[model samples]
Target chain A: MQERVNPDKANLIAGATGDWEVVIGIEIHAQVTSKAKLFSGASTEFGGEPNSHVSLVDAAMPGMLPVINEECVAQAVRTGLGLKAKINLHSVFDRKNYFYPDLPQGYQISQYKHPIVGEGDVILDFKDGSTVTVGIERLHLEQDAGKSLHDQHPEHSFVDLNRSGVALMEIVSKPDLRSSEQAKAFISKLRTILRYLGTCDGNMEQGSMRADINVSVRKPRDDLGTRCEIKNMNSIRFIGQAIDYEARRQIDVIEDGGTIRQETRLFDTRTGETRAMRTKEEAHDYRYFPDPDLLPLEFTQDYVDALDADLPELPDAKKKRFVEDYELSAYDAGVLIASRAASDYFETVATGRDPKLASNWVTGDLFGALNKLGKEIGESPVSAESLGELVDLISDKTISGRIAKDVFDIMLETGEAPAKIVEKRGLKQVTDTGAIEKIVDEIIAANPDQVEQVKTKPKTLGWFVGQVMKATQGKANPQAVNDILREKLEVGEE
Target chain B: MKVDEATVRHIARLARIKVTDEEAKNLETELSAILTWVEQLGEVDTRNVAPLTSVVQMSMKKREDQVSDGDCADDIIANAPEVADHFFVVPKVVE
Candidate 1:
């Protein structure tokens, strides 16, 4: 609704000691969209009955061996491609050793030395129209541990294995992100890319997608300082707040002559402050080794080529095409391509009509309606074709722009076709020159005193034009009424 | 792999297993000997060979993605050592 307060600038924390530059790297865990778990046949549906979606392998029962899920691996590869990252043909899954009841398996099956994805870059678009490319370090596939619930029973805690063994792509980024907005933008753009690929449903509310941010502060032009990790930020707003709070907290610590500890901290959303969850000294040294059960994942270039051929038009591509082909603004194109459904909806309405008008309706009215009704674009009562028809009616001047609005409102409420609404309501523009001229003459004959004043005061023509349009119930073509008023009244001749 | 006295105690705690001091001293000797035997692999000079992670050369076989199993909470709870209300109960895990 409004411009962001601060312009895109260097992420500097001004301190009494010095101006501290904040550096950020994010590790995002995106759950691969699959019907089954990574190594088990269990379902991946969220909010299922506790342990009702689990398989024996997920429980780590005796003599249980894992069979890889094809869909999950394909999803990971698809996600890697979406990020513009290199896909490693042969990557190994290692056992990340740790012990927790939630992690039924004594060690987590993950990738360490050899991840499935190599280095890539994500171009972040700022509100100021400037962009920065953030480097993606690596992306690897891993299994999620179970959920430990502490609230149900006061005396005893419970474990839900429904989430256990669900495949997650752990995407690690280089310390390239500087500002909080840049970080938020990176996640949002990445989420859009993931959703476009149909690989991962980036639903943070359901724990399908989450971020862990590594934040550090150093003087400008200085080497990176000792960093701390803020764990499990689920929302973009919370991620920004956490980075702001943590960066300031670190600057304060250093200025007070205290060394910041290299540790994992938890961001308390309610308190808006971070507290140490675990110190580096207490960190677990995960003795990683390749899993003995699963073999190295390898595929031919032909397989990757097939997936690439099937790749949907990504956000960047769609945005560029919207700007170039549809002649839309970058901001408008960005809004349109934020989701595939919205983009497809926009294209349907923009095909033959004025692209600017279509953009305004899609971004302004349609989105406003959807938001007000708490409905998704796909769930819109009015079809894209209907909206497009309404746009056509307006573009051809069959209906006045004002009349088209009323027609659109009726279409939205009744889910009726726009043309039908205009026809049934008799709302078409009165561009018939005969009918319009008659009204113009009638108005002039009745308002002679106002017409005499109109010659010297040319602005008085608007009053005559308004009267004509009002007499026609706002269905008169405004340009036609202007010409008729000026010609019939002969006000402009003097 | 160095098996120092402190590392011996740390490994036990990392695995969440109880080990007595006397047992750690004895285990350290055995562990050091095993590691020394493993150290002989350092002399191999074949530098171009790929590290073999899996002894088997087959690609991982995948199954059809489905939820053909589960929905048996009673069976799942039956295997747990302590179960309360169809959930595996443990000492409360904070954070």
Candidate 2:
């Protein structure tokens, strides 16, 4: 990825004395791609009726044997391989004891001491050209708790078990993020990697993925200070804002002779501030123990190797290939490889076409239009072949670059092929020099009084050129008209 | 690691359960005795021993990624204490 254009004052938290460096680490809870719940044969689809997707096992019924879902484990391994992390052949699940109204079982089944995936690293490319590698401490499989809908009734709360027992992959990262921007970039890059690997959809809106940001500010070469965790931040924009708010809040507290307390806080999106949640001052003892209902999760080297063989091209590698093979700037490559579908769409459009032209249209006009319409590239009205053909028309001088924009708008509205639209509308450029010069001669003849002024007011010559283009219905070659007019008007000027 | 009356009372409050002072005092003695008895395992010098997380050794079992098991709300919520409109409702929580 190309470096950010304005990356000068990056990731720095300015304080009273000097710029204080903020240490950031994020824990992401990504829902595993599976058809059923982790322990029960229940649906994991979103927007289901409140209790429609629940099963007896999910409701903590007595004598319900918790059967593990195999696809969930495989998806975690695939994610681990995509991160280039170690896939532990042997892992364990333990019960995380807790109490909440939504938790029907009074405990969550999670991997405590022994996780499935270990020690992976992700290289995040900034918009300005710099890159940093954040370390993945581990990826553990856990079961999600049910939802408590407090808004359902005015006087009572309702419990929804649809999400309960769904599989979750909690990927923890090391404290390698230096600033809020870095934290956001790390998440975006990680989301791209996850989408490419087909493990988790990484949809933060539906709560398929959420982040817990641990932020602490310290002076240069100082020890780590008291850190606070902002929990369940879903939006990428909100993550950056929350980190900035928390970091500054900490610095202010310390400068005002108040000691920072380590606690869990929530980011209030409405007020754009961080508020501490009411909880015990001391951390709760999770009291994790091995779940006796299930056995140790073990796999073979062949299983890990097979999953590795099927791994897709991750974002970093794909971005590097786009830069090396297509000769595109890192910025363009980064934008193109933001999503798997976008990357595939770009490859098809860039093939056998002028790559730089293809890159500009795809990243600039195409993306801009989609952003306006609030649509994804996959849902675009203009297909890749149509856009590619439009680029080809400009490259081959069939239509000038300006005419291509008109044709593109028509294509978006009418879904017509670029060549067909150009043909029907007579938008093709007039490449014949003889035809262009004839119109140019006619313009100079009619405007004799203004022709003498062309020497002193060279800028007004554009009016004569525009008149010629208007006469030809905007099909005349712009360069041919300019050259013929410049040559003809130069006769008496010298 | 020693359990005392004050610690027992605090734990009960954290767990959101009601425990009387006499019960807490009696429970502390029993809990401390159990903890003291279990502390004998710590005396062993098993520095090289690997930590055991699971007693039964097996691989993870998986199912195909297909949404096949829903639409049984009546059966799933059969044991709820109170239900309204296919939902389990509790006394209103202010927080």
Candidate 3:
């Protein structure tokens, strides 16, 4: 693989006037995977009966004070550590004052100035063996608003407090991305890290994780342009489409001699366009202040150290180890370590076996079968031991690679061990050179015309080898058959 | 620290409160006086002192992440102005 190159050099959009560079920053709100709400003793289940998971604190009842959930705080710190960020020894929560139907307290409890996480970096890896380090501005802990169902009734919207007060870690990135491809890669790598840390599930479809993208376009080497924020993008595909559209829209506005307005816009997936939201007549003034009810969150360095010590090996490190230890290619290492379960499966299968062979089997054939069956690595029918055993049989010359493939298919269907399948079906390779030589002699005797042609054109010796394998029902040792044919036909003398 | 009529009207709208022009006019004088009174604290020469994080000096209390309280849908909606299917109903907000 080639050395990693700067992503900034590869991602400049050509416009009508000239090449315009898109500047992108993202704020990802990842719901913390905790059993209870952030400040309430309520179940943090995804889909429950309306208001079924709400506590008195979640509903903001009269004189109901919020009590911090320790697990949620630990989760945020773990996420910060997973991002290799600076964990603030002391952080404070503030009330972001706004009026919304989904917000029961008329304000969201968020972090304004002192977030729990400080500056970090996420390394975005591209398929071209190139990399970009996206700087994380900060990560803060916040409370999620509830759901508002407007179409439930004609006159009134129904509010479900089930999601209210749920803990969310807002991971904000600096404006380092220059294109939609970089943005997509940044989000994907961040999501993989969060999932590896077990801090967030990173399920976009479930609204557990979402993105607010800030997009702007400027001439190369020019000052930063005014940016508009796209709110609540849940899909990666739609995020790319929205950024492309929004950047082009901003470029067109500037080309028409109109300045771009900084506002929050929503992406219309159906239309593949972004339109400005019907903002309040006045610009948003969140009027943030420290929450009077909750005190400042403080922890010791030992706490952060303990959490960091317990973190699993993140994706980039694991991929590096795979490349170094297994001698797998960068792309193969990436595919094998995309998920924890798949990586674990590969490690187990490659423990004592040929690592390159195991990597090929796991990433190629096994992954293909899993995709066809709609199964994750955790639900694979073929155990790691069995797959490793199949590789071992190929390595030891107990079965040819072609017969091993058939054996692997049977192992997938029957969940049987590869060795047992080979034994039961008598599919072992004819490694007995005597038997293979006899079959090769018979095939050569019947094909003298093709043998004569092979002396002139040496590549036609494959025909004699193929005929020997066909005569032996593909169980002949292919190398032995080729060796015997070349000796019998004297094709190797030249 | 002057709170004008426009500022009063903006605050009123943000608080989701209805106000008459006369009320806003009165609030402009009252709110400006309150801000002027609160601004007197800025004149103190205690620049080196840290901001008071809490009135009580105790650390923030935390609870374990366990579902110890919930499943009270009926009690949660008992005080709502309108409730249906255990959900609080509000004026249609389409944005």
Candidate 4:
């Protein structure tokens, strides 16, 4: 292990006296991808009618007990394995007592001391070709509370129990982030891993995943400062803004000789500020105890091994393979493997073809065009096989590299195959020596002064080659045009 | 094991119970004696015994991931004090 500087001054804020470093930690609540709730047989579908998905067990009806959902347990274990975390074979559930209109039951079933997953780490890849490992403290399973609609009625709030008792995997990270950029990258990578595992959909818009950010600022090499948690951020943009605002806020308070009070805050999206929602003056004593209704969750080593064997190729492993097998740069591999859809698309195009050329086209032309159109790679108009065929046209010299771009544009506009586009548009390269030599002969005859200069200067042969290519409508093979021009202009001896 | 007046009041507040002064005075003494009797269990020396998780000796029962129940919103809100659009309506809570 390398010894890293904890308070990196690179991410320091300019305080009144000096610079201060920001330390951040994130707790992500990812809804598990299961059909039923965590401890009931109710449907876990989103956007259902109010209270229509609630079961007796979810509503805390008399004589109704919760029966754990088997798929939810498997999903949590899969997420733990995806994070490279340790899976505790023996874990227990406890009751977290709280008061809220949304919580039909007074206590929420969560894991307190013993979580399902232990220590793990996620590798965050930055755009500068740098990587850092963020330590995951633990991941525990809990039930999601119901939704409360405050705007539906004037004096009353409507409670919808559709989301109640849904399973959530609270993946907590250590204070290993220094800047908001790192925090955003950490969440993005973790969400990608979850999506790949099919454990969570990772949709922040529909509220499948949410984050609670902890921000603190301390002097270099000093002890950690008091941190405040900004709760329930769904968008990555908001998370970045919230961290910057909170870090500056804390630095101002300390420079003004005010002690930072530990509190929970909310990020106002409209004003881009963090406001205190509650303070820690009245501490909560949840009095968590092992739930008497449920037994300890115990599994064998063989069960864990089965799930481990069933895991698909994760992003890290896929990236390593792309680098070693495909001979791609780390940056290109990172971009391709960031999402499963794009990575799978690249694999189809690069198989048994020129990989570097395929990568350039996919990451350069396809990505740029998609960005212009505001379309995801999955919704791209050009198919991977069509793009691969375009690569083949360039490699086989049927079309010059410049003409291939024209064919690609036509392919984008018409959604036709590259070969079909080249044939229908008559864009084939003029590679025959007879045809190119004729054009080369005409160019030399037309530019006598340039031809005289080319024999002595020899570098001016490029001018003759450009004229030949222009005369042929950019369909002339560049290599053939250069060869014929050198031979016809008598500049070969030079 | 001794329950004081303030502790009694705090517990009542947490439970959201209304207690009169006379009831608190009597309940403090009653709770202390009950706790003292229960504390006698600490005298037993069974250090090697495991903590009990359940009264019944059985593993956790889990169900398959199938939507086998629900869709009776009327029955669910039948006991609520107020209902609107199949939702249980309560006093407005901003937080």
Reported per model, the fraction of native interface contacts reproduced equals: 0.79, 0.70, 0.91, 0.82
| For candidate 4, the TM-score of chain A alone relative to the native chain A | 0.92
Give the TM-scores of the predictions, in the order they appear: 0.93, 0.94, 0.95, 0.93
Candidate 4, A1-494: lDDT as tens digits: 22243655577889889998998999999999999999999999999999999998888888889889988999999999999999999999999887788888888999999999999989988777878899999999999999999998899999999999999999999888999989999999999999999999999998999999999888876778999999999999999999999999999999999999888899999999999985433247677889877899888779889999999999999999999999999999999998899999999999989889999999999999999999999999999999999999999889998998889888889999999888888999998889888777777777789978987898888788778878899998888887777777777744
- Which segments of model 3 are wrong by more than 4 Å? A1-7
lDDT of candidate 3 at residue A186, scale 0 to 100: 88
Clashing pairs in 3: none
Tens-digit lDDT string for candidate 2 (A74-112)? 899999988889999989999998777788888899999
lDDT (tens digit, per residue) of candidate 2 on B1-95 = 58988788777775767888788888898889989999999999889997764564645455566665667899877878898888889877533
What does TM-score give for chain A of every model?
0.92, 0.95, 0.95, 0.92
List model 3 lDDT by residue over A1-494, tens digit each: 11122336558887789888899999999999999999999999999999999999899988999999999999999999988899999999999999788888989999999999999989977778877888888999999999999998899999999999999999999898889988998898898899899999999999999999999888877778999999999999999999999999999999988999989999999999999999877557889999999999999999999998999999999999999998998888988888898999999999988999999999989999999999988899999988999999999999999888899999999999998999999899998989988888777788779878988999988888778878877888888887877888888734
Q: Which consecutive 10 residues in model 1 chain A have the weakest lDDT in total?
A: A1-10
Highest-scoring model, lDDT? 3
What CAPRI class is candidate 1?
Answer: medium
DockQ (Cα-based) for each candidate: 0.73, 0.60, 0.86, 0.77
lDDT of 4 at A114: 94
Error of 4 at A261 (Å): 0.4
Model 1 CA deviation exceeding 4 Å by range: A1-13, A278-280, A437-467, A486-494
How well does candidate 1 match the true structure in TM-score terms? 0.93
TM-score of chain B of 1: 0.88
